[model samples]
Target: MSTRPILALISGANRGIGLAIATGLARQGAHVLVGCRDLSKGETACKALRAEGLQVRPVELDTTSTASVTRLAERIQQSYGYLDSLVNNAGIGVDDDPTLTTADRLQRTMSVNVLGPILLTDAMVPLLEASGRGRIVNVSSELASFGLRADPDWAFADFAMPIYQASKAALNSLTLSYARQLRDKGIKVNSICPGYTATEATNYAGNRTPDQAAVVAIRYALLNGDGPTGTFANDHGELPW
Candidate 1:
Protein backbone atom coordinates (compact mmCIF):
# COMPACT_ATOMS: atom_id res chain seq x y z
CA MET A 1 0.00 0.00 0.00
CA SER A 2 2.94 2.31 0.51
CA THR A 3 5.97 2.34 -1.81
CA ARG A 4 5.90 -1.41 -2.17
CA PRO A 5 5.57 -2.89 -5.63
CA ILE A 6 2.13 -3.94 -6.89
CA LEU A 7 1.46 -7.62 -6.26
CA ALA A 8 -0.41 -9.32 -9.13
CA LEU A 9 -1.32 -12.83 -10.17
CA ILE A 10 -2.12 -14.03 -13.69
CA SER A 11 -3.54 -17.52 -14.18
CA GLY A 12 -2.55 -19.72 -17.17
CA ALA A 13 0.61 -17.71 -17.51
CA ASN A 14 2.78 -20.60 -18.68
CA ARG A 15 2.32 -19.64 -22.32
CA GLY A 16 0.32 -17.70 -24.89
CA ILE A 17 -1.71 -14.66 -23.89
CA GLY A 18 -1.43 -15.40 -20.21
CA LEU A 19 2.38 -15.46 -20.43
CA ALA A 20 2.36 -12.21 -22.37
CA ILE A 21 0.14 -10.60 -19.74
CA ALA A 22 2.48 -11.70 -16.96
CA THR A 23 5.50 -10.30 -18.77
CA GLY A 24 3.75 -7.03 -19.57
CA LEU A 25 2.62 -6.51 -16.00
CA ALA A 26 6.11 -7.28 -14.71
CA ARG A 27 7.64 -4.68 -17.04
CA GLN A 28 5.23 -2.15 -15.55
CA GLY A 29 6.94 -2.68 -12.13
CA ALA A 30 4.49 -5.13 -10.66
CA HIS A 31 5.79 -8.18 -8.79
CA VAL A 32 3.87 -10.77 -10.78
CA LEU A 33 2.96 -14.32 -9.83
CA VAL A 34 2.63 -16.59 -12.85
CA GLY A 35 -0.10 -19.18 -12.25
CA CYS A 36 0.01 -22.36 -14.26
CA ARG A 37 -1.42 -25.84 -13.94
CA ASP A 38 2.00 -27.25 -14.65
CA LEU A 39 4.55 -26.23 -12.06
CA SER A 40 7.50 -27.00 -14.30
CA LYS A 41 6.14 -24.96 -17.14
CA GLY A 42 5.38 -22.04 -14.84
CA GLU A 43 8.88 -22.25 -13.39
CA THR A 44 10.30 -22.09 -16.89
CA ALA A 45 8.23 -19.04 -17.71
CA CYS A 46 9.22 -17.29 -14.50
CA LYS A 47 12.86 -18.22 -14.99
CA ALA A 48 12.78 -16.53 -18.35
CA LEU A 49 11.15 -13.43 -16.88
CA ARG A 50 13.59 -13.34 -13.96
CA ALA A 51 16.40 -13.39 -16.48
CA GLU A 52 14.98 -10.10 -17.78
CA GLY A 53 15.44 -8.71 -14.26
CA LEU A 54 11.69 -8.63 -13.64
CA GLN A 55 9.93 -9.38 -10.40
CA VAL A 56 8.08 -12.60 -11.14
CA ARG A 57 7.41 -15.91 -9.37
CA PRO A 58 5.73 -19.08 -10.51
CA VAL A 59 2.79 -20.64 -8.67
CA GLU A 60 1.11 -23.98 -9.28
CA LEU A 61 -2.52 -23.49 -10.12
CA ASP A 62 -5.21 -25.56 -11.78
CA THR A 63 -8.20 -23.33 -12.33
CA THR A 64 -10.64 -26.19 -12.61
CA SER A 65 -9.95 -27.56 -9.11
CA THR A 66 -11.45 -26.00 -6.03
CA ALA A 67 -8.64 -27.44 -3.91
CA SER A 68 -6.08 -25.81 -6.19
CA VAL A 69 -7.83 -22.46 -6.05
CA THR A 70 -8.14 -22.64 -2.28
CA ARG A 71 -4.51 -23.54 -1.87
CA LEU A 72 -3.44 -20.56 -3.97
CA ALA A 73 -5.60 -18.19 -1.96
CA GLU A 74 -4.16 -19.52 1.25
CA ARG A 75 -0.58 -19.29 0.02
CA ILE A 76 -1.01 -15.71 -1.15
CA GLN A 77 -2.70 -14.80 2.09
CA GLN A 78 0.28 -16.12 4.01
CA SER A 79 3.07 -14.89 1.73
CA TYR A 80 1.84 -11.53 0.41
CA GLY A 81 -0.90 -10.83 3.00
CA TYR A 82 -2.81 -9.08 0.22
CA LEU A 83 -3.09 -9.03 -3.55
CA ASP A 84 -3.33 -5.93 -5.73
CA SER A 85 -4.75 -7.60 -8.80
CA LEU A 86 -6.22 -10.90 -9.95
CA VAL A 87 -6.30 -11.80 -13.66
CA ASN A 88 -8.42 -14.79 -14.59
CA ASN A 89 -6.83 -15.93 -17.86
CA ALA A 90 -7.21 -19.69 -17.81
CA GLY A 91 -9.75 -20.84 -20.41
CA ILE A 92 -10.39 -23.69 -22.83
CA GLY A 93 -12.80 -24.62 -25.59
CA VAL A 94 -11.95 -28.17 -26.45
CA ASP A 95 -15.56 -28.82 -27.29
CA ASP A 96 -16.08 -26.32 -30.07
CA ASP A 97 -18.60 -28.28 -32.09
CA PRO A 98 -21.89 -26.92 -30.84
CA THR A 99 -24.03 -29.40 -32.73
CA LEU A 100 -22.14 -32.52 -31.74
CA THR A 101 -21.03 -31.48 -28.25
CA THR A 102 -21.91 -33.91 -25.50
CA ALA A 103 -22.83 -33.11 -21.91
CA ASP A 104 -19.42 -34.23 -20.72
CA ARG A 105 -17.66 -31.94 -23.16
CA LEU A 106 -19.88 -29.00 -22.27
CA GLN A 107 -19.29 -29.63 -18.58
CA ARG A 108 -15.52 -29.76 -19.07
CA THR A 109 -15.46 -26.52 -21.05
CA MET A 110 -17.69 -24.67 -18.60
CA SER A 111 -15.75 -25.97 -15.62
CA VAL A 112 -12.50 -24.42 -16.86
CA ASN A 113 -13.77 -21.33 -18.67
CA VAL A 114 -16.56 -20.17 -16.33
CA LEU A 115 -16.76 -22.03 -13.03
CA GLY A 116 -13.00 -21.88 -12.51
CA PRO A 117 -12.82 -18.08 -12.52
CA ILE A 118 -15.88 -17.79 -10.33
CA LEU A 119 -14.34 -20.07 -7.74
CA LEU A 120 -10.95 -18.40 -7.90
CA THR A 121 -12.36 -14.89 -7.72
CA ASP A 122 -14.53 -15.74 -4.75
CA ALA A 123 -11.54 -17.26 -3.01
CA MET A 124 -9.32 -14.25 -3.76
CA VAL A 125 -11.84 -11.60 -2.66
CA PRO A 126 -10.72 -11.65 0.95
CA LEU A 127 -7.07 -11.17 0.04
CA LEU A 128 -8.02 -8.48 -2.44
CA GLU A 129 -10.14 -6.72 0.17
CA ALA A 130 -7.05 -6.65 2.37
CA SER A 131 -5.18 -4.72 -0.34
CA GLY A 132 -7.59 -1.76 -0.35
CA ARG A 133 -6.84 -1.42 -4.07
CA GLY A 134 -8.08 -4.73 -5.36
CA ARG A 135 -8.67 -5.24 -9.08
CA ILE A 136 -10.05 -8.21 -11.00
CA VAL A 137 -9.64 -8.61 -14.76
CA ASN A 138 -11.56 -11.31 -16.55
CA VAL A 139 -9.93 -12.39 -19.83
CA SER A 140 -12.86 -12.70 -22.18
CA SER A 141 -13.38 -12.84 -25.96
CA GLU A 142 -15.43 -10.83 -28.46
CA LEU A 143 -16.98 -14.08 -29.49
CA ALA A 144 -18.93 -13.69 -26.28
CA SER A 145 -20.40 -10.46 -27.57
CA PHE A 146 -24.06 -11.11 -28.08
CA GLY A 147 -24.35 -7.71 -29.70
CA LEU A 148 -21.76 -8.43 -32.38
CA ARG A 149 -22.83 -11.98 -33.04
CA ALA A 150 -26.40 -10.89 -33.67
CA ASP A 151 -25.28 -8.55 -36.42
CA PRO A 152 -25.57 -10.14 -39.85
CA ASP A 153 -22.53 -8.31 -41.16
CA TRP A 154 -20.22 -9.30 -38.34
CA ALA A 155 -17.21 -11.42 -39.26
CA PHE A 156 -17.41 -15.04 -38.06
CA ALA A 157 -21.15 -14.51 -37.78
CA ASP A 158 -21.88 -17.92 -39.24
CA PHE A 159 -19.48 -19.61 -36.86
CA ALA A 160 -20.70 -20.42 -33.38
CA MET A 161 -18.75 -22.62 -31.04
CA PRO A 162 -21.51 -22.83 -28.48
CA ILE A 163 -19.40 -24.37 -25.72
CA TYR A 164 -16.66 -21.75 -25.92
CA GLN A 165 -18.82 -18.68 -26.63
CA ALA A 166 -21.31 -19.50 -23.92
CA SER A 167 -18.53 -19.83 -21.35
CA LYS A 168 -17.18 -16.34 -22.14
CA ALA A 169 -20.69 -14.84 -22.12
CA ALA A 170 -21.13 -16.34 -18.68
CA LEU A 171 -17.76 -14.81 -17.67
CA ASN A 172 -18.96 -11.38 -18.83
CA SER A 173 -22.03 -11.79 -16.66
CA LEU A 174 -19.76 -12.62 -13.72
CA THR A 175 -17.77 -9.44 -14.38
CA LEU A 176 -20.89 -7.28 -14.03
CA SER A 177 -22.09 -9.16 -10.99
CA TYR A 178 -18.75 -9.01 -9.18
CA ALA A 179 -18.12 -5.37 -10.07
CA ARG A 180 -21.42 -4.23 -8.62
CA GLN A 181 -20.96 -6.37 -5.54
CA LEU A 182 -17.41 -5.22 -4.88
CA ARG A 183 -17.96 -1.54 -5.63
CA ASP A 184 -18.39 -0.62 -2.00
CA LYS A 185 -15.08 -2.37 -1.31
CA GLY A 186 -13.40 -0.34 -4.07
CA ILE A 187 -12.42 -3.40 -6.09
CA LYS A 188 -12.46 -2.70 -9.84
CA VAL A 189 -13.85 -5.68 -11.75
CA ASN A 190 -14.16 -5.63 -15.54
CA SER A 191 -13.90 -7.88 -18.57
CA ILE A 192 -11.28 -7.64 -21.33
CA CYS A 193 -11.92 -9.08 -24.79
CA PRO A 194 -8.44 -10.13 -25.84
CA GLY A 195 -8.92 -10.45 -29.60
CA TYR A 196 -8.17 -13.61 -31.53
CA THR A 197 -4.46 -14.14 -31.08
CA ALA A 198 -1.95 -16.57 -32.53
CA THR A 199 -1.88 -19.09 -29.72
CA GLU A 200 -2.10 -22.81 -29.29
CA ALA A 201 -5.74 -22.37 -28.30
CA THR A 202 -6.47 -20.90 -31.74
CA ASN A 203 -4.22 -23.35 -33.61
CA TYR A 204 -2.15 -20.26 -34.52
CA ALA A 205 -4.73 -18.94 -36.98
CA GLY A 206 -5.45 -15.54 -35.46
CA ASN A 207 -4.06 -12.32 -36.88
CA ARG A 208 -2.66 -10.86 -33.65
CA THR A 209 0.15 -12.08 -31.45
CA PRO A 210 -0.24 -12.93 -27.78
CA ASP A 211 1.55 -9.73 -26.80
CA GLN A 212 -0.81 -7.69 -28.99
CA ALA A 213 -3.87 -9.24 -27.40
CA ALA A 214 -2.46 -8.83 -23.88
CA VAL A 215 -2.29 -5.03 -23.83
CA VAL A 216 -5.90 -4.42 -22.83
CA ALA A 217 -5.68 -6.85 -19.96
CA ILE A 218 -2.54 -5.16 -18.65
CA ARG A 219 -4.31 -1.79 -18.89
CA TYR A 220 -7.29 -3.02 -16.88
CA ALA A 221 -5.00 -4.67 -14.35
CA LEU A 222 -3.40 -1.29 -13.63
CA LEU A 223 -6.58 0.81 -13.67
CA ASN A 224 -6.94 3.85 -11.46
CA GLY A 225 -9.70 4.37 -8.91
CA ASP A 226 -11.89 6.24 -11.40
CA GLY A 227 -11.47 3.65 -14.14
CA PRO A 228 -14.62 1.99 -15.55
CA THR A 229 -15.94 -1.17 -13.91
CA GLY A 230 -18.76 -3.64 -14.53
CA THR A 231 -18.10 -2.94 -18.24
CA PHE A 232 -16.55 -4.73 -21.21
CA ALA A 233 -13.86 -3.32 -23.50
CA ASN A 234 -10.92 -4.25 -25.72
CA ASP A 235 -7.69 -2.76 -27.12
CA HIS A 236 -9.67 -0.30 -29.27
CA GLY A 237 -12.55 0.73 -26.95
CA GLU A 238 -15.80 -0.39 -25.36
CA LEU A 239 -17.75 -3.25 -26.85
CA PRO A 240 -21.51 -3.92 -26.81
CA TRP A 241 -22.63 -6.28 -24.08
Candidate 2:
Protein backbone atom coordinates (compact mmCIF):
# COMPACT_ATOMS: atom_id res chain seq x y z
CA MET A 1 0.00 0.00 0.00
CA SER A 2 1.10 3.53 -0.66
CA THR A 3 2.53 5.01 2.52
CA ARG A 4 1.64 8.59 1.65
CA PRO A 5 -1.38 9.89 3.56
CA ILE A 6 -4.52 10.18 1.44
CA LEU A 7 -5.48 13.79 0.71
CA ALA A 8 -8.98 14.46 -0.60
CA LEU A 9 -10.52 17.79 -1.61
CA ILE A 10 -14.28 18.18 -1.69
CA SER A 11 -15.60 21.36 -3.30
CA GLY A 12 -18.62 23.20 -1.80
CA ALA A 13 -18.08 21.26 1.41
CA ASN A 14 -19.38 23.85 3.83
CA ARG A 15 -22.79 22.17 4.00
CA GLY A 16 -25.28 19.76 2.53
CA ILE A 17 -24.09 16.77 0.51
CA GLY A 18 -20.59 18.17 0.13
CA LEU A 19 -20.16 18.37 3.92
CA ALA A 20 -21.46 14.86 4.29
CA ILE A 21 -19.01 13.54 1.71
CA ALA A 22 -16.08 15.34 3.27
CA THR A 23 -17.03 14.12 6.74
CA GLY A 24 -17.29 10.55 5.52
CA LEU A 25 -13.82 10.67 3.99
CA ALA A 26 -12.31 12.23 7.09
CA ARG A 27 -13.83 9.46 9.19
CA GLN A 28 -11.97 6.97 6.97
CA GLY A 29 -8.64 8.65 7.86
CA ALA A 30 -8.21 10.71 4.72
CA HIS A 31 -6.97 14.25 5.17
CA VAL A 32 -10.08 16.09 3.98
CA LEU A 33 -9.91 19.55 2.43
CA VAL A 34 -13.21 21.38 2.61
CA GLY A 35 -13.57 23.68 -0.38
CA CYS A 36 -16.18 26.40 -0.08
CA ARG A 37 -16.99 29.70 -1.70
CA ASP A 38 -17.55 31.23 1.71
CA LEU A 39 -14.50 31.39 3.96
CA SER A 40 -16.36 31.58 7.25
CA LYS A 41 -18.69 28.76 6.42
CA GLY A 42 -15.84 26.59 5.18
CA GLU A 43 -13.86 27.17 8.35
CA THR A 44 -16.91 26.44 10.44
CA ALA A 45 -17.47 23.19 8.60
CA CYS A 46 -13.85 22.14 9.01
CA LYS A 47 -13.84 23.14 12.66
CA ALA A 48 -16.78 20.90 13.36
CA LEU A 49 -14.99 17.96 11.76
CA ARG A 50 -11.77 18.85 13.58
CA ALA A 51 -13.66 18.76 16.87
CA GLU A 52 -14.40 15.18 16.01
CA GLY A 53 -10.62 14.64 15.68
CA LEU A 54 -10.67 14.05 11.94
CA GLN A 55 -7.90 15.46 9.78
CA VAL A 56 -9.77 18.30 8.10
CA ARG A 57 -9.04 21.78 6.82
CA PRO A 58 -10.86 24.52 4.97
CA VAL A 59 -9.87 25.92 1.57
CA GLU A 60 -11.69 28.87 0.02
CA LEU A 61 -12.69 27.98 -3.50
CA ASP A 62 -15.14 29.49 -5.95
CA THR A 63 -15.28 26.78 -8.54
CA THR A 64 -16.58 29.18 -11.19
CA SER A 65 -13.61 31.51 -10.91
CA THR A 66 -10.37 30.79 -12.72
CA ALA A 67 -8.28 32.65 -10.19
CA SER A 68 -9.96 30.83 -7.33
CA VAL A 69 -9.51 27.41 -8.92
CA THR A 70 -5.87 28.19 -9.67
CA ARG A 71 -5.31 29.26 -6.09
CA LEU A 72 -6.83 26.03 -4.85
CA ALA A 73 -4.35 23.95 -6.89
CA GLU A 74 -1.44 26.14 -5.74
CA ARG A 75 -2.39 25.81 -2.07
CA ILE A 76 -2.76 22.03 -2.33
CA GLN A 77 0.50 21.66 -4.21
CA GLN A 78 2.33 23.72 -1.64
CA SER A 79 0.79 22.06 1.39
CA TYR A 80 0.33 18.37 0.50
CA GLY A 81 2.46 18.16 -2.67
CA TYR A 82 -0.20 15.96 -4.30
CA LEU A 83 -3.88 15.05 -4.24
CA ASP A 84 -5.21 11.50 -4.01
CA SER A 85 -8.86 12.29 -4.52
CA LEU A 86 -10.99 15.16 -5.86
CA VAL A 87 -14.76 15.18 -5.36
CA ASN A 88 -16.39 17.80 -7.56
CA ASN A 89 -19.36 18.26 -5.25
CA ALA A 90 -19.94 21.96 -5.91
CA GLY A 91 -23.07 22.74 -7.97
CA ILE A 92 -26.05 25.07 -8.26
CA GLY A 93 -29.74 24.68 -9.09
CA VAL A 94 -31.16 27.89 -10.52
CA ASP A 95 -33.10 26.72 -13.52
CA ASP A 96 -36.38 25.98 -11.82
CA ASP A 97 -38.09 29.19 -12.90
CA PRO A 98 -40.75 28.55 -15.52
CA THR A 99 -40.00 31.88 -17.19
CA LEU A 100 -36.23 31.39 -17.27
CA THR A 101 -34.72 31.56 -20.73
CA THR A 102 -32.77 28.50 -21.87
CA ALA A 103 -29.62 30.41 -22.75
CA ASP A 104 -29.51 32.27 -19.46
CA ARG A 105 -30.08 29.15 -17.41
CA LEU A 106 -27.59 27.09 -19.38
CA GLN A 107 -24.91 29.74 -18.96
CA ARG A 108 -25.36 29.86 -15.20
CA THR A 109 -25.67 26.12 -14.68
CA MET A 110 -22.76 25.26 -16.97
CA SER A 111 -20.44 27.74 -15.33
CA VAL A 112 -20.44 26.00 -11.96
CA ASN A 113 -21.55 22.48 -12.79
CA VAL A 114 -19.74 21.83 -16.05
CA LEU A 115 -16.98 24.35 -16.70
CA GLY A 116 -15.78 24.66 -13.13
CA PRO A 117 -15.09 20.97 -12.67
CA ILE A 118 -13.41 20.77 -16.04
CA LEU A 119 -10.96 23.51 -15.20
CA LEU A 120 -10.30 22.33 -11.65
CA THR A 121 -9.71 18.75 -12.69
CA ASP A 122 -7.44 19.80 -15.53
CA ALA A 123 -5.42 21.85 -13.08
CA MET A 124 -5.38 19.12 -10.39
CA VAL A 125 -4.92 15.99 -12.49
CA PRO A 126 -1.15 16.34 -12.42
CA LEU A 127 -1.15 16.23 -8.64
CA LEU A 128 -3.48 13.25 -8.69
CA GLU A 129 -1.22 11.53 -11.21
CA ALA A 130 1.71 12.02 -8.86
CA SER A 131 -0.15 10.01 -6.22
CA GLY A 132 -0.11 6.95 -8.54
CA ARG A 133 -3.61 6.03 -7.33
CA GLY A 134 -5.83 8.97 -8.15
CA ARG A 135 -9.61 9.21 -8.06
CA ILE A 136 -11.94 11.89 -9.41
CA VAL A 137 -15.55 11.67 -8.33
CA ASN A 138 -18.00 13.94 -10.11
CA VAL A 139 -21.24 14.58 -8.18
CA SER A 140 -23.81 14.15 -10.89
CA SER A 141 -27.59 13.53 -10.82
CA GLU A 142 -30.14 11.09 -12.26
CA LEU A 143 -31.79 14.06 -13.97
CA ALA A 144 -28.77 14.12 -16.23
CA SER A 145 -29.50 10.69 -17.58
CA PHE A 146 -31.32 10.93 -20.88
CA GLY A 147 -32.57 7.38 -20.64
CA LEU A 148 -34.27 8.01 -17.32
CA ARG A 149 -35.75 11.30 -18.47
CA ALA A 150 -37.15 9.75 -21.59
CA ASP A 151 -39.37 7.54 -19.48
CA PRO A 152 -42.55 9.46 -18.76
CA ASP A 153 -43.20 7.17 -15.79
CA TRP A 154 -39.93 8.13 -14.06
CA ALA A 155 -40.49 9.36 -10.53
CA PHE A 156 -38.84 12.74 -11.08
CA ALA A 157 -40.43 13.38 -14.45
CA ASP A 158 -42.24 16.39 -13.12
CA PHE A 159 -39.06 18.05 -11.93
CA ALA A 160 -37.96 19.65 -15.19
CA MET A 161 -34.95 21.89 -15.03
CA PRO A 162 -33.28 21.56 -18.40
CA ILE A 163 -30.20 23.61 -17.63
CA TYR A 164 -29.20 21.73 -14.50
CA GLN A 165 -29.96 18.41 -16.16
CA ALA A 166 -27.93 19.25 -19.25
CA SER A 167 -25.04 20.46 -17.13
CA LYS A 168 -24.79 17.11 -15.39
CA ALA A 169 -24.97 15.28 -18.68
CA ALA A 170 -22.01 17.35 -19.79
CA LEU A 171 -20.29 16.50 -16.52
CA ASN A 172 -20.87 12.78 -17.10
CA SER A 173 -19.31 13.18 -20.53
CA LEU A 174 -16.30 14.87 -19.02
CA THR A 175 -15.96 12.07 -16.47
CA LEU A 176 -15.71 9.49 -19.23
CA SER A 177 -13.23 11.59 -21.15
CA TYR A 178 -11.02 11.96 -18.10
CA ALA A 179 -11.27 8.30 -17.22
CA ARG A 180 -10.10 7.31 -20.67
CA GLN A 181 -7.35 9.89 -20.84
CA LEU A 182 -6.01 9.11 -17.38
CA ARG A 183 -6.44 5.35 -17.49
CA ASP A 184 -2.82 4.68 -18.34
CA LYS A 185 -1.76 6.90 -15.44
CA GLY A 186 -3.80 4.83 -12.96
CA ILE A 187 -6.47 7.44 -12.25
CA LYS A 188 -10.13 6.49 -11.93
CA VAL A 189 -12.80 9.00 -12.94
CA ASN A 190 -16.50 8.40 -12.48
CA SER A 191 -19.80 10.30 -12.14
CA ILE A 192 -22.40 9.47 -9.51
CA CYS A 193 -25.95 10.53 -8.67
CA PRO A 194 -26.40 10.64 -4.91
CA GLY A 195 -30.16 10.32 -5.46
CA TYR A 196 -32.57 13.00 -4.27
CA THR A 197 -31.07 13.76 -0.89
CA ALA A 198 -32.18 16.21 1.73
CA THR A 199 -29.81 19.19 1.69
CA GLU A 200 -29.90 22.96 1.46
CA ALA A 201 -30.01 22.59 -2.31
CA THR A 202 -33.23 20.68 -1.95
CA ASN A 203 -34.43 22.66 1.06
CA TYR A 204 -33.93 19.45 3.07
CA ALA A 205 -37.18 18.09 1.74
CA GLY A 206 -35.95 14.80 0.22
CA ASN A 207 -36.32 11.52 2.08
CA ARG A 208 -32.61 10.67 1.90
CA THR A 209 -30.23 12.29 4.33
CA PRO A 210 -26.98 13.89 3.15
CA ASP A 211 -25.01 11.09 4.80
CA GLN A 212 -27.10 8.51 3.02
CA ALA A 213 -26.61 10.27 -0.31
CA ALA A 214 -22.85 10.43 0.23
CA VAL A 215 -22.33 6.70 0.76
CA VAL A 216 -21.75 5.65 -2.84
CA ALA A 217 -19.60 8.67 -3.59
CA ILE A 218 -17.35 7.85 -0.63
CA ARG A 219 -17.15 4.25 -1.83
CA TYR A 220 -15.97 5.37 -5.27
CA ALA A 221 -13.34 7.64 -3.78
CA LEU A 222 -11.83 4.73 -1.86
CA LEU A 223 -11.70 2.39 -4.84
CA ASN A 224 -8.52 0.42 -5.45
CA GLY A 225 -6.45 0.72 -8.63
CA ASP A 226 -8.28 -2.22 -10.13
CA GLY A 227 -11.72 -0.76 -9.68
CA PRO A 228 -13.86 0.27 -12.61
CA THR A 229 -13.62 3.76 -14.08
CA GLY A 230 -15.77 5.86 -16.44
CA THR A 231 -18.88 4.57 -14.70
CA PHE A 232 -22.11 6.46 -13.94
CA ALA A 233 -23.62 4.84 -10.89
CA ASN A 234 -25.50 5.33 -7.61
CA ASP A 235 -25.96 3.42 -4.34
CA HIS A 236 -27.50 0.40 -5.99
CA GLY A 237 -25.45 -0.07 -9.17
CA GLU A 238 -24.85 1.32 -12.67
CA LEU A 239 -27.26 3.99 -13.93
CA PRO A 240 -28.51 4.46 -17.48
CA TRP A 241 -26.86 7.05 -19.61
Tens-digit lDDT track of model 2 for 77-176 = 9987889999999999888756768677788889999999998898899899988889999999999998888899999888877778888999999998
**Residue lDDT tens for model 1, 126-208:** 98899999999999988999999999999979886888889899999999999999999889999998998999998999899
- In order, candidate lDDTs are 0.92, 0.91
- Pairs that collide, model 1: none
Instruction: Show the lowest summed lDDT stretch of 10 residues, model 1.
Output: 93-102
TM-score attained by model 2: 0.96
Using TM-score, give the best candidate's number. 1
lDDT score, candidate 1: 0.92
Q: Candidate 2 at 60: error in angstroms?
A: 1.0
RMSD of 1: 1.7
Off by over 4 Å in 1: 97-101
Error of 1 at 150 (Å): 1.5
